[model samples]
Target chain A: MISIKNLSFAYKKKPVFDGLNLQFKAGHVYGLLGKNGTGKSSLLRNIAGLLYPQNGSITVNGFTPFERLPVFLEDVFMVPEEFYLPDISVPDFIKHYAPFYPRFNSEKFRNYIAVFEIPADSTLQNMSYGQKKKVLISFALATNARILLMDEPTNGLDIMSKSQFRKILAEALDEEQCIIISTHQVKDLENLIDRITIIDEGKILFDENVETITKKLSFRFAYDAEDVAAAIYSESSLIGNVIVAPNIDGDEGKLDLELLYKAIITNSEKITKLFQQ
Target chain B: MNQFFSLKRFTLLVLKHWADNKKRYGLSVLAFIGLLITWFVFTMLTGFDNIPMGKAVQQITFFLSLFAVGTFYASQYFRDLGSRSKGINFLLVPASAFEKLLCSLLYSVVLFFIVFTTAFYLIDVLMVAIANSLPGTEKLAGKPNVINVFKVIILRFNSDSTINFLLFFFSVQSAFLLGSVYFEKYSFIKTIICGFVAGFILFCMMYFFYEHLLPNGGFHKGFLTSFRVHVDGVNDHLVQVPRWIGEVFRFLIMYGIAPFLWIVTYFRLKEKQV
Candidate 1:
């Protein structure tokens, strides 16, 4: 579990977060959505204790993250957007790094790497970027850390690897773990993330569960001009107007994350009002 | 299981650090040995007639290379902290700051000294033997003895110049280590510049205080503790601290500087953000 209260953080003169309060609980994968410079990675870094908050506090599993106690660190693993692995073989990396985590399962690591199709004896430096990222992801998951903070985890992955990433991530989750992924590629996380926290301008624009989002909003193409005009957020496509409007029907529609993200970002007030209601 | 200083965690950290950097370390040591051989061979060919190949050449080579290599090694120890990805990899390792700092001290101070001294002696012995075996050189001058590095003297600056230089080396090396963590880029050069600027500022401050701020008194016997003042007619008054206090201060200056810098380095590491 992580709790952030009135957190204010900045990089030198440029302010990132001001009085931002957020909470992440175990057992759910949180998709942190935001524009390029909206502090999505910064938020994840703050939670991981890589970046210190200028004001207020962040408590992860009853410990101040900035203290970076071994106990706290062993339970939290971060897959940074830009990551570095030592110029060593996979087995050597695991041999040296795995002991640091008490819950590390070597078998699970091997399984994840197998799923990712990365060679066990391959040297990390000699591998391609995607291969390296897969190795890092596999290692991160196998650490079995309670809190896994991933930033742009799918950035370098091929189409198949991205799906493999989603599969392994879904399989890796448990009731005692929390995974917060900050990424711009929302489509890759279609059914993987259970909760969505959209941030814009250092503030939480929308925070909702996938089930609730599907129930509250409808994502569909509208051929009717009136429906397109009345929709909360609509984009004109060649075939029809893709509309994200209030889901008035009782039947739950599938959640379209990309469309939902756009609807929230474009017409946040109406969408937020609908969610509130 | 102790969080702050777990022996298991420390061992793992040391092992992990070694595994991560063993290749680079191996290459660096090899390069150092190669450079030493080249320098010693050059010195033998050019300076054998003028410079004594025994204590003087060995001693000078030992100290000069020690300072140059030692400080550069310490500066590079934490250079990974300069980059965001590497810094995150470093800091997020499951070890306390104390353990990390202790591991750094182990490599930069203890291990570096052992390896450097071994390499120096290895080259020193070979070079000395080659110089002594040279045709007609042994008869023209006394045999060139291989210097026992521990016993070599430099200008009689202290009872044991080796020990003095070793302590000074640690102090300067520790500063460079701190600078490696403190500055993001060009840490070695920045630390040297900062050291020069700080030394100059301290010199000016001391000169101004002694000459203008304080009464007309000049420091004499030992570090700032003994001063002589001149009255118009009376014998120049000599003021000095108690011998015990002066001895303590002296001991601290010689031994405390490295650990002092180490403490600063530790705190800076704790405060380091990436």
Candidate 2:
């Protein structure tokens, strides 16, 4: 579990987060949705102790992350968007790095790599960017760390590999693990993320669960002009006008992540009020 | 399970560092040996008289290479921290700052000294043997012999006291190590420039304090030991600090500097962010 309170961080003169507060609980995959430069990665870095907060504090599993104590580090793992891997074989990497984490599961690591279709003895330096990313993802999951922070994890994966990533991630979770994924490709993680937290300009615009979102909001195409004008958020598509509206009939429609994101960004006040009610 | 210091974690960190850098380390050692051989062969081929690979040559070669290679190696030890990707990898490793600093010292100071000394002596012995066995070498005025490197005194400021060059080398190398953590890019060059600037400032401060602030006197018994001043047509008087104070100062200068720099390096590493 993680708790952030009144956290303020900045890069020199540019402020990233100002009096921001959020909470993350175990047993959930949080989809951190934000436009570019919305402090999503910064938030993840702050939680991981890779960057110091200018003000306030962040506590992960009852420990301050910036202290970077061995015990704290062993329980938290971050798969950064841009990562580095030593120029060695996969086994050698595992041999050297896995010992640092007491909970690392080698069998799970092998299974994950096999699912990713990575060669057992492949040299990391020779692998493509996507392959290297997969290797990192597998290693991150296999660490069995209590808290995992992933930034743009699906950036470089191929189409099928994205599906593989989703499947592996879904299988990797447990009741005690917390995963916070900061990504722009929400569709790649459609069924995987159970909670959505959208941020803009260093503020949380909307934070809700999939069940609540489906229960209160309707996502579908509207053929009638009256439906289109009455919708909270609507966009013209080639087939019809797609819209997101209040779920008055208790229909519990499937959540459209992209449309929901658009709706929040464009008509946040109404959607947020609806959620609050 | 100890957070600050754990033997198991420290050992794992050391082994991991070696695993990641063994190839680079191996190549560096080989390159150093090759350079030493080339320098020695050039000396042996060019000298017409006397012992070409004598004590003087060995000492000069040993100290020069030690300073050059030692500082460069120390400056590069933490270069990974300069890049975002690499810095994340490094700082995220499950080891305390103390353990990380110890690993850096283990590689940069302790192990480096052992390996460098061994490599130097290996080349020095082989090259001296080759030089002494050359035909007509018996006619030389001096005998070619391998020097006891530790006993060599490169800095003899006074007749009664001699400072060990190894201490000076370590102190300077530690400064560069700290520089590697402080500066993000071009750490080696930046550290060297900063060193020169700091040295110049310290020299100026000392010069001004002695020449303008103090009486018309000069330090005759080495630096900071004793001062002799003219007393207006009277017998000159010598002022000196207590023997214990002098000894303490000497101890601090020779041994305290490296450990002091190491402490600063540790704190810098603890506060490092990516």
Cα miss at B124, model 1 (Å)?
A: 0.8
RMSD of each: 1.4, 1.6
Per-prediction fnat values? 0.83, 0.85
The positional error of residue A144 in candidate 1, measured at the CA in angstroms, is 0.8
Q: Please give the CA lDDT of all the candidate structures.
A: 0.90, 0.93
> If you assessed candidate 2 against the hidden native complex, which CAPRI class would it receive?
high
Kindly list the per-residue Cα lDDT of model 2 for residues B143-170, writing each as its tens digit: 7888887666665754322245678899
List the candidate 1 regions with Cα displacement exceeding 4 Å.
B48-52, B214-217, B232-234
- Name every residue pair that clashes in candidate 1: none
Runs in model 2 deviating more than 4 A are B48-50, B156-163
Q: Looking at model 1, how many pairs of residues clash?
A: 0
lDDT of 1 by residue, B1-274 (tens): 7888999999999999999999999999899999988877777777644643656667778899999999999999899999989999999999999999999999999999999999888877887778778877656546787777777676476777777877888999999999999999999999999999999999999999888986676788786889888676377788888999998898998999999999999889988898
Residue lDDT tens for model 1, A1-277: 8999999999999999999988999999999999999999898888888888999999999999989999999999999998899999999999999999999999999999999999899999999999999999999999999999999999999999999999999899999999999988999998899999999998889989888988888899999999999999989889989999899895699888999998888889898899998
Accuracy of chain B in candidate 2 (TM-score): 0.94
**TM score of chain A per candidate:** 0.99, 0.99
